[model samples]
Target: MSRTTPAPWRREPGLVGRTVEAFLSPLQDAYLRDTPSAVARLAQLRRGAGKAPEEVPELYGLTGTEGLYAQGPFADEKTEQRATVAVHTAVTLYALHQQSQRSRRMHRTGYELGAAVRMLMPSGEIDEPLRRRFVRVGTATSEAIRADRLRELVLLLRRQEVPLDYAFLADQLAQVQVPQLAPRVRQQWGRGFHAWRPPKATDSDGGGSKGTDTSRDAG
Candidate 1:
């Protein structure tokens, strides 16, 4: 029988964000670091994503502060899983949410954040407490963006080459009843987003890109 590997969150307080970063490292390599254009995008963001804003949420700590995700005494599997998912979801969501509140410079933040969050979802649906938080975060983000600012969001989405190319996200969005935006989003991302090999923990050397400036908006 195979043993289940322990989650990275089940470790020392200081190690949490680094663990998540490590978790994302392969994705980074495949999506951003592997290609010249993608690397250029990453360098642009890394150069310009800027320092943390005052009074931002701890979720975005991955880019700015680090070690802010540390939580102690996780009792069991469920708790650990929740913490992990919440970290990724919150970081991804809040990063864009904060950006949308700031300026049009972060307009693409919403598109990238939404893509990352959807990528992190389990199925087209996430359950319970986490789902509620996700919805709350989404609502807050929607409110921040408002109708006038949504065109920017759409424009940003149009620029992405998201690696997700399937009905899963469409189904997931429908599952969340999030206003039928998935088909349109899928349309924007288009066929190039679909990599020949499916996404996994370790990214592939194959050619494809799902770009984002997801980090660097930490609170």
Candidate 2:
């Protein structure tokens, strides 16, 4: 018999993940509280999605360099740029997710992108078109294309009122920028897709529960 190895998420988050949480949490909170700055930032970030940071000059001050280097600076400029792209993509996707739903928090902790897509299915079964979209996102040749594909999925998730973990997503997005690390990120997403199950109906009153936590804290 073989013992199962622990999933990556079982351990504490690394520097990049911590950085994402540090930066995104305050912005998320401010948005939830209806702060003017956060609202304007969200709009700007949304416009920056799937575009290069250089193209979005307005996104400069909002990147939160202090949070990115909270654990100390990156070893090189390339690494730093990749990390910035990840933070930008995750935050912008989150802005798109939160659009027009000011009363609801769309950035829920622990909800992976794949699992969030799974939640969109009515029967919790594989939906061909949706599955194809997920595949396209994973197979995207460029981070720009990947971000665009992710934006499409985010729209679907918004329709269903599903939430995602932007902090975890930022970490994954950062890893995906590295050739070797990209495979692991893809594997994590695959696991999330396979592991999700629909919410079980309540036996007590023969009705389903509302406002439930659907996230699986897995790799």
TM-score of each: 0.21, 0.85
Clashes of 1: 3
**Which whole-number lDDT from 0 to 100 does residue 49 have in model 1?**
21
| Residue pairs of candidate 2 with colliding backbone atoms | none
Error of 1 at 131 (Å): 25
Q: Indicate the TM-score of model 2.
A: 0.85
- Give the alpha carbon lDDT tens digit for every residue of 61-153 in model 1: 443223323445567665344333333332232233222221212211122223433433343454454334333434433322222132233
Which structure among the candidates has the greatest TM-score? Answer: 2
Candidate 1, run of 10 with poorest lDDT? 1-10
Query: Please, what is the whole-model Cα lDDT of each candidate in the order they appear?
Result: 0.30, 0.73
lDDT string, candidate 2, 100-208, tens digits: 7765667766677776776676554679999999999999998889988998999988876677777788888888989999998998888877766654543232333
